[model samples]
Target chain A: MSTTRRVVIEPLTRVEGHGKVTIRLDSAGEVESARLHVVEFRGFERFIQGRPYWEMPVAVQRLCGICPVSHHLAAAKAMDGIVGVDELTPTAEKVRRLMHYGQIFQSHALHFFHLSSPDLLFGFDSDPATRNVIGVAGAFPELARQGILMRKYGQEVIQATAGKKVHGTGAIPGGVNRSLTSAERVELAADIPRQKRWAAEAVAIARDYTLENLAFATEFAAFPSNHLGLVRPDGTFDLYDGVLRAVDESGEKILNDVEAGRYADVLVEEVRPWSYMKFPFLRELGPHKGWYRVGPLARLAVCERIATPEAEAARVQFDEAMGGRPGTMSLAYHWARMIETLSAIEEIEQLLDDPDIEGDDLVRKGERRPESVGVIEAPRGTLFHHYVVADDDTVMRANLIVSTTSNNEPMNRAVESVAKKFLTGTEITEGLLNHVEVAIRAYDPCLSCATHALGKMPLVIEIQDAGGRTLAEGKRNS
Target chain B: MSESFTFYIDGVPVEAAPGMTILDAAQAAGIWIPRLCWHEELEPFGGCRVCTVKMNGRSCAACTQPAEPESVVENDSVALREWRKALVELLFAEGNHFCMACEKSGSCELQALAYRLGIAAPRFEHRWQAREVDASHADVLIDRNRCILCARCVRASRDLDGKNVFGFTGRGPERRVAVNSDARLRDTDLDVSDRAVDICPVGAIIRKGVGFTVPIGARRYDGAPIGSDVESANDELESANEHTEGGAAATVRQEE
Candidate 1:
């Protein structure tokens, strides 16, 4: 008789949020389907209801500790509309951009060095005991130290601009509250050369790892999907504020430069009963085919070029290496992430040199509007914050499309692709499951932000027969 | 004229008038006895009890207890510190402070007191009680979720502003600050310039459109502890006394 069984890997490791994967195998022990399940749920959208509209910028930071600045800026941008100012003062915009690049720099550095470096350095199928950040620290001490210091530098930049490292109140409706001081400028500028060098070295590390394992990198969970991010009006990489653009796998613009306020017109989110995270897709293509990949790889694919010189050069080389096509390789995310890090550091250097960041003309005023939408390219990917304020200035409703939610479909596809390629039998092993986790980690999914929940569960692999009886079980507590 | 008397606070001599409470005497002597509901501009309500101090072997509200002659007061004792810490923690647990996003964060007396007393987080479980916000007023917002029942606004509105715009309602956990009107704050005679708006020790009552204007580091309490100003005044007094003693000793040495 033909036998069908399911294998479940619960609570994936080395990622920001709590999630699991379940794969079903056919009679031939061939993978049939795999799904990534977000296990926690937090109703942040409902939490922000009835709060003052100005509080959104600070209150929404509670959504994700890892990327509170992203939420802060996104909500502030939206509130800028509620206050009816389409453009901010020069100083306000620059300070906010500085804060954002600092966030991107720190977030990307942390992911590459602390989270993903272990897999790249030690190999995916290595001993599960030492296959972590500790392992990376033991093997590549200097690289690990650089990662930590780089993260600290970025955090300092954040504190200097946002007033606090976590849950900053720097960005407010209409404008920012404070400008960068000249002393802060000098202090941050002093570290730019070192940061630039380290960022360049990080890019090299990711690039070398990808090229060294070219065969594995190209084939691992590789597939064509749509890409989405923000791009400057001049078609260059922009992480802070920009018009939204999305392209298909062939680099064709499916959704052109749509203003951030009009994002709801282009994208729609579909909810499934199985997971708390909603699947967001291009409105024109429907849910199935409209699903797209986000984050570093998607940003690189969607943007025409990086505006900074060093990063632009790196992007050129990256494109040349990809044969001038949008790279669908899941592992290539590390390379793109490093390139963006370099770009962020470069932008930070330029902003520090500019005098406008220290200007006192920080706030602006305009007429009021009841509804507004804010979109920005967060460290992970495109994040959207939409709010409808009552005439009394309280938030009537709020809808958030976090980066992880946008990449939900892509991450599921990645898990299935990896499982199909790696799964050999009904019994789940550590090495085989790590392969699945490695694919998901490439997306750098923040399930906490995606599900808007708290707490996490342990990792469990259950082998179930066709009748749903558990045949074998493996567990790893976290 | 009131009769002046002398008392001892933590063994330090403090002079006070007959009508002065222990808190008033401490402040006059440049000693800060932390009190939430004893603003200088308002009558002493003694509601918070954060200023509870042992006077003549009995604990009493320092803000209301009269400073008697020859009275020995025990302030800043370890037991008093812990009791005060618990009181602050309870106040924190009773309200949904949300200090992180509050406009009054750095300048807020409650938060500054918590920092001064080294209360990292409330030990008790948070009472996330549902509360109402009165944003109907054109220029004033009363977010009752942050109210600690200090009654500063009630006192200020009635005594100082002469508008009687705010009052207390309900009892126990249900008790909260209420507007004089049956409905929202807009219906009340409260104005933006009312001292009641500025007298709130927390974000419970605040002027609208003025939140988060001050940068983090420049705020009132960011540079020092909450009572540091009062403590600094004590430092200045001690230095002055030392200078006087030095001058007298110099004169004696010259005579010798």
Candidate 2:
């Protein structure tokens, strides 16, 4: 008689939202497949149907507390298109850009040092209780403090420009509602050098650690897949403003310079029965070949140049070290994250130095248009906020494609690859189960942003024998 | 007696003056009854039924009802709260209150009442009724879609500003706020300093060119809930009364 066994991992820890990893084994105890189930559902699109277009930027920020600024700016960008302005006033543009960079700086710092560092600084197999930011703080006090301060500085920058940090209503249609005062500008610029040095040190430490663990880093969910990101007209990395680009595993461009508003023309989303998040893919390639990786690693892979000097140097080393290929190793996300943080810090410094940043010409008036699509390279990846407005300026429809959801297919494949490689027998230890979480964490996928659910679920891992009887389980509340 | 009055609100005895209304006495005692269209600066206009409270087991508008001595008031009961919530839902349904997008969102009394009452969503189906926006005013916009027929603007215009520029027309669902001058606000004797512009409870009467002047998180009601000050006031008053004689018993009784 043949019997099938199912292993379920619930509420993946350190990540934003509740998610489960289910792996089924055949009667022969051979791996069948693995799936990441997003258990929460949020209907932001359905309820926001009758809202005003101008309010979308603020409303959409409610999607994720960790990355509200990304949604704020992306929604504003879409509203700008509706307002029929291609470019904002210089002061308005600089203010919004500063806010965006601040978000990127803080979000990257949060994920890298606070979230990912616990796993990397302390070995993955280390005691779960002591394997966290607290553990990192106990081991490397200065590193942990620097990480905290880095995020604090980023928040300060955000507060100065956008006004109350997270979910600030700074950016609006046509342009921003307020401008940076001279004092606010000085306050932001004052801390740049310290932040810059900290970013550089973080990149050095992350790169060195990644290089030292070359073997495991290369083997951890390392598979060739497509990479996607946004790039400036000159092919430089840009998080806030740019055109989308998609490249194959060999660093060959498949989709280049696609306008942000025209995302639907090139991409499509497919729903799956197992997860709440819909899998997005290239329109032409369909599901199989269409799956691609996003976020820092993908952004680094697609961009040819870094606009800032220090970040450019780090990118060069990163590309060469990662074999000059997109999707070389999933673990390289940490390294690329550090590089992006450096870029964000540099951009913040530059924006602060610009005199126009403190100018008072913040907003422009215009007639409302019928529809708009906004896109921005959020800290995670590309974020899209599309809205249709009636003649009265009330929102008729709202469609959002968050970064984590866009990476749904790639995340699932990565989980499976890690599970197949690591899960050898029936006995699933905490350390072994952590290997699976490490793969999901490598992507730094914000399941909260993806699912948009009301409440969070605890991360759980259950190993079941032949007839789906629980053999072992691992659970963590945090 | 000394011409003073005392009433039991939520079964706790509260002091009041003879002529003071229940709403006024409650305000002096730092007890909050969710209300709209009854601004302290303006005369009582019980157009909004949100402040309906159980007076001796009968429903009455708290803002207009005078405080009667020895009367039992049921202001904070589950059934009364639900009834109030239902009234708020009706208001929300009647008007186009897209709080997420409104300029007066954080400061809007209607939105704050909804938030304070924990009304996450309106229970009733929304009447997506089309309303005209009177942008004829060069400085002010009268978006009828967001108007809740609170009459605060009308009262402010007629009484406070003495312009008598705003009034209500029609009846029931068709009843709407209208400017006195048939032409436009610019043609009327209205300026940037009109009281009606600032008296709107919703986003209906907003000054143009200054939309979203306050950043969202920094806006009113962002840092604290709408009636948090009132709650604090109640605590302060209760503690102050405790410093006086016979306060501890009243405080304990109110808690119970």
Candidate 3:
């Protein structure tokens, strides 16, 4: 069977943004190769020229409403660096970290619990009518409720700390302007215990699930650690203020102290005329072959230790599943996220009780900067924000490298593996192609964030036989 | 417990009982809560909900709630808290808050809070209710859609100004803080200094054409706590009404 077939998914709708996927089959309509397409274009870098310094926060935060807090905080930190305000008053730093925690807690929960799990827990063909979390609620009500409750608690911290959740005015250039009282603190403090429980449950569930999928791990796995977030010596995650380190599957830190200023030297971005998204690869690995990843799962692999207890335990669970060392299995990435959620909760609780936060001396009134860069471990991956400003405080230029762009190479490998394994020499069938898309979905690629702003399937097939010689190749959208 | 303590608030201090209201102490100190529906001139009315505060225990309506033992109650806390978010959510859901489309965005307490709190979207669905805009008075225009039920207009109409020119016509989210005479503002016996204009929080009751004259950033409540702005707000309202059809707006001027 050497027939060629085509599966094309255009204007990938329903996700946060957009993308396209193309599948090619052989002569007998058997599969040949699979290519995932990312499409959408907006030149935020070229577009941010000639804006005011203080005004950049308002503008960059709009880049992603889902993680506005992180963007704003990172932007603030970069501006601080640019203006030489390295020492943030105790209260401002405390508030800044607390709000940053809010972003992590919410964004990760939305992904691991709400977005991706709908498929993993529910099973793809469990009747579309009852295939959502609402359906999951009908079946596993407690798990679903716990998921939502944890999300609510995380969002509540954001709301209580910032006066509102999505777009908060809590982060100012020099420092924060708002203060929290003891009563609000006590009220907020009460949510920690409940949050802790949900994180534990999530971790436990991830552990059990990973144990079930051994072949997917031991046989087919690919992750390059050459580029990812670095944890600090203090053990806490270094998202907003930290170093960038990339590792290979063999536990090697090839690059270290890759500061935001030098990101261009090590990282190279290229564009495909077919798709709008620009792919970023590790220079050492070079071009299409430079396989790298970012975000939570990539973070755990590169770091030496997790500062918090829950996260440490989750790391242990990962080691146990991988037999002493967790390699590059995408399935285990789900469990790793659970560990991250736990780490976020514990860190937030400790931050809320910081003594420095209780006193004054947060903001320094007027401390404008000339230029700066901000970076954070966005849930999908690592997000970077760079800004240049004139003496007039207006923005001169802006560039952003969304997290999903980094994982481009490895994600392609996954699709290539799945397509090759399932469709090596058979007639192209619908179910096989749908399975290809699922593998990519497993990465949870946020196309909406990837192109700097801007799939279908089918059935099973027959036995080995000399099949009809397929003519020209065509792509199908199901 | 009865010993008087000196406290400085916006440059004013007044002695109060161990359990007296900060709003009351401010009034005694001549600091004023600048509240709506609150009358030292009459019985306390909490419906205005504009006199909310941040006390030691929790945020509460200052008109109906008391002060803590040692801490001063601030209304900004109430205006920016969960209750305020919910209250604003309720207000937004109850009425249409289209700023660019409405005449009150710059002067609207609702819009000001949205900007202050960074509320980009109204959490709940807008009611989209079509309200009556009564222009019966030769000079006064009553737009029921803009009424936030702070009751400043209602209380000012009946108690202080004694014109009885306004009263709330309905209840709940549907309540209309309305004019009493059922006539346009200009057709009533109401004078320009009527407290109704003073008590109005949003631009529901302006003297007309003063909407764009003052820059939104420098308005009275910019730095003032939410409910606390009501008292001083009346004087501004009274002054605004006194200049009815007169020209005065700082950077800009209302219609002549």
In candidate 2, what are the lDDT values of residues A182-286, reduced to their tens digit?
898887788889999999999998899889999987888888889888899778898888888999989888997898789999999999888999999999899
DockQ of 1: 0.48
Q: How much lDDT does candidate 3 score?
A: 0.61
Report the CAPRI category for model 1. acceptable
Question: Chain A only: TM-score of every candidate?
Answer: 0.98, 0.97, 0.87
Q: Write the per-residue lDDT of candidate 3 for residues A88-185, one digit (tens) a residue.
A: 88788877777777677877777666655665776543454554556777888888888888877777777655545665556666676565667767
Q: Model 3: which docking level applies?
A: incorrect
lDDT scores in order: 0.87, 0.82, 0.61
lDDT of 2 by residue, B157-252 (tens): 889898888888888888888887875666677777988888887888887645566765566766555555664678855554343222322232
> Which number leads on lDDT?
1
TM-score winner between 1 and 3, please give it.
1
**For this target, which candidate reaches the highest TM-score against the unseen true structure?**
1
Better of 1 and 3 by lDDT: 1
**TM-score rank order:** 1, 2, 3
iRMSD of all candidate structures = 1.1, 4.1, 14.6
Report the poorest 10 consecutive residues by lDDT, candidate 3 chain B: B247-256
Model 1 lDDT per residue over A53-84, tens place: 88888888888888899999999999899988
What candidate 3 gets wrong by more than 4 Å, as runs, is A1-3, A10-15, A217-227, A233-236, A323-326, A365-369, A423-434, A454-478, B1-256
Superposed by TM-score, candidate 2 places the C-alpha of residue A56 at a distance from the truth, in angstroms, of: 0.3
